[model samples]
Target chain A: MSQATLNRLADAGFSGWTTVTGRTLAAYQAAVVRIGVALTFGGFLLREWPHRRVLYGDLSPWSGDLARQMLASNHAFTVLAWSDGRWWFEGVYAAAIAVSVLMLLGWRTRATSLLFMVLVLSLQNRAVLVGDGGDNVIHLMAIYLAFTRCGQVWSLDARAARRGTRRTGDPVGVVVWAALGLALAYCQLSGFASLGMLDFGLYSWGTFFWLCWLLAGLRGLLARRAPEGEGLALLDALATLVHNAAMLVIAAEVCFIYATAGWYKIQGSLWQGGTALWYPLHLHYFEPWPGLADGLSGSSTLVTAITYGTVIAQVGFPFLVFNRRIKNVMLTLMIAEHLGIAIVLGLPFFSLAMITADAVFLPTGFLARLGQGVARGVARIAATPVVRQTIMRAPRTPERDPEAVSVIR
Target chain B: MADEPDEATSPEPIPPLAETPDLPDEERRWSLPSLLVLYLTAVAVAVAVVYHLGTVFLSIAPANPVSQRHATAINAHVLPEFEQNWQLFAPNPLQQNIAVQARVQTVDSTGHRLDSPWIDLTARDVAAIRGNPLPSHVNQNQLRRAWDYYTAWHDQQTEKSTGFGGPLSEEYLKRIGLQRIGRDWEGMAVIQIQFRSATTDVTGPSWTGAPATTSPSYRQLPWWPANDDDYRGLGVS
Candidate 1:
């Protein structure tokens, strides 16, 4: 192309580019909000008023042994440091959970968010066998939230007495934006990795489905801030189209997972009549409930129905999840599937992690409302003057000029 | 704004712009150091997450865990089944089959020349002849198969060679029944033999434009043994 033509094209592209930048920045802002909510909620869930342990304590000895083995294998990494007979790991886990709870509560929000990120990374690094995809997603988001203005609103840090005294513009938002970009890159890599596993074709399908859900979730968030314009509108329109395309790719991946798994299971003779359900129960490693397998075996019809149902549910999940009613039913079936696997197959940790990711498909409004409720409860306790004063007096930027506040925010 | 005279040109070098911005109270923009720190921290966290999760996901499915355990259990249950199923079927059989026949001259504890009667044993029954029911300690099944394998080759040598006297000298024969043999130098009590099969010339009907012949003929060749020395050479001292 001629230089004149190239210049013209560049000029045209610049306008579209700025709009994209603006939209992306807005998306980053929204992502920060979502991440903040997730962290705060997760943190609160960690803290126990009565000092009771819930999730980690429930992990079986096999799971613990597996974690120890993983830690031992990767000793050079030293990602997980366990000393004093479980004191270090347990202490870190508890502290992380507590910080996560505090982050959710929005009390000393930034500090807690930072600590939570550190602790989570430490725990995750120490034990490769204990985590799942949800842990990965949450950890990534938590790191982003730690550096963002996630505590700007609906937080004890925000509602302090000296609220307007603090400088609003912090590069914490930029850090979060970078983190989100990294997350996108990670998900893309994860998707490609899943596709690489050709031998376990059906398992790849599951991974593909997961990647699709991740893309769809991200797309849904991005769609809210799509730009408005005439020529710019067309660019925005193209972005939406791309987002839709991403969603379709994810959908296709999900379909592949279910279809391949269904086919593989059905092709196997033992899986058709429900006799295979007892196989897991018979295995010493996986038998969580021993007699239950015998009971399931006795009812061949029930077992067969479950087998057929699992195949149908898995195959239909991508399509069915689109429909609100069917989605709920599918969600229920997925839960049941995981629960059944946990009891019969003894994969409690895996089942729980998978179940948690499935929760992402629940109505965003429902989660938002839950977040609001938690925020309200936190606000009530944190309304005291002493707590307010402590947060307000925590830190202040050197610039006290009120005029500069509106320049950034 | 232009009428307000340029600050530097108008009068007494209107105090440096840096000094005029209300000392420490001036608007403090986000600094590069702060941004760098936050970015580094975020990147570090990202790395940790990826490293931890990647290792976990990759390590979930191992190929040999169940197979290793099951092989041990199966071995315990059916040892004889492995013994009964041995066979010597290679695509192309070796030309020079070697055998070792040895007689150990030693008393069983009383220092007498061990003149035990010659025991007739089939090559396939060497494991039984040696009175060692179990296979060797090596994990590879091929090693166990090798024992039955080379013994069959030795049997083929004894059967093919009519006059074994040239290679099977008295000194060599004495070594066979007591000491070690084979490429691996495995020590075992057994006879060693070595010989080469004679090459045969084919003479048949001319179905494919070739001349027909009346008979097939064979020629003898010197034997090249597989093992270093014949089994008869090694005596149990």
Candidate 2:
């Protein structure tokens, strides 16, 4: 790489990094992934609840000895694998479930999101063989979510923050600022420590803070240069960068999954013959209902069309995303195809998982409308006097901006 | 010089921090502390963004000769949790229906061969999951994976890629077979397991081309020493 070429690359990278600052982003859009993932996991838990003991409990058919031997060969690690004791397993298992619920409700989201990631890692790691494509997508998404302001809206934490702000009076008193600072410190520190930042050996965390102060002091001596009303929002900018970057990364992941699948299908002789669809229809493991499977397999024209349609959709999905109209047409068909897979293959979680991940690419406007419609429905239901009184016990006061109280440095 | 104020409009020297409690976070940006924080934060973000994108790139890398060069780094970065492959009913869907069944041979004090009847483990899964909207993870993945693990070890072709006969497979088959019988048999000292795979060449939707279906072939494993390690099976049984 020549210096000029390197310079050009650096310039390009710098431009790409700055573009997110100007681009339109709806952080709240991530709520869809959160809600979808939580519901899917919750549904998974409920379905797996009865069998939990046998699958993961101390009483599992895979005895402790067998499991240890298996783990020794596999080189996979999980906190659950540390012990096969029933009580220890149950406690850790229960804690994972509770943390997931808390994360779903968006209570102390930063902390809960971290815990949720750990839980997914621990549980999924414990049984490596028993996870499908759905588990893979969720695993990556959980870690990506840790960097986001995922609790910005539609969460219990958001609601409480809003409520707390409303209860405080204007002039934004000194006490309020101090209290807010303390709260921010507490919450942020919890998240930081959970992420293992507090483990910086030799140097105390306070020293790091002191160094930052010294740097800020030296930086203060430099002349101010930013345009007026530009809040710097340095931390906010970092958060946005990370959040957007993750979204892009995950979206790329989904696209590549489709592209590779399509590309491989393109390579296969069966697909070229247009008889590729005939196999899955006949596969007994996938055949949940023989009558239905055979019923669908009866039409050669339908089968060929579907086979070609799936290939075309998966192959074209990446290209289509660059064009709005085409993207909409393609995504609709893709979603439908996944739904079809769910019904035909009897893999609801896998389909829903893909659909949920795809939902991230859905236009913010569409999600906003969906959110509004849901809110409207809730409001309409609340019109019933008894229901309204029960759910809305707090007397009506205008909702306040939670960020208004964030006056502390 | 040109921007300086005259004697009539001279500005006061800046006040010390202890006297400036009223300054909000943004107003204090010109301070050395906040600017230092901002610069440090930007640097941190840059490093983090680079690391994350690098890992993600490797994880979702395209399958090509170019990517093969970085295969080791990609593998290290994406091993375990993020390791990805796009091979779910891909290019070609499976044409075989494999049923894993387990039966036991028991010996009494008289050395008589008492037999435990064959149990269709996959059948129970099919029945439990067939009409149900939400299938348990066990139903979704366990038996299929168990069979896959077994075959991956046993298959001659797979051995060329992923070497087989690891302890994982050894324990894995035992777990799956034992799960079928609830693991406990008072007199059973040994267990035997087998599978039947029924395959058919996919005929056209027209069902023409001299319709061909291969007879289901049975593959059995040698009897393994049994342990009385039966925990109650998932309540589905």
The numbered model that scores best in lDDT is: 2
TM-score of predicted chain A against the true chain A, for each candidate: 0.45, 0.73
**Which parts of model 1 are misplaced by more than 4 Å?**
A1-78, A81-91, A103-121, A129-269, A339-349, A365-409, B1-237
Q: lDDT (CA) for every model shown?
A: 0.38, 0.60
For TM-score, the strongest prediction is 2
Summarize candidate 1's per-residue lDDT along A1-409 as a digit string, tens digits.
9999999999887554333222222222222343444543353334322221112221111123333444343331222332323444456556666666666555544345555555555554443223333344454444444433344334444444124322222233334434544643563465532213211344232353344334333433332243111222232223322322322322333344344445455555556544445344443223335466567655657756776676677657767878988888788888788777655654443455445445535554454556568768878756644454345452355533344344334
> The CA-based lDDT of model 1 is what?
0.38
RMSD of 2: 11.2
Model 2 agreement with the true structure over B1-237: per-residue lDDT tens digits:
000001001123212111111113323334566456545765766675666556655556456665577777666556655666776566677666676777776666676777677667777777876766566767657877877876776654433224444545655666666666644456445544434333234444556554565555566565566554332332313
lDDT of 2 at A224: 28
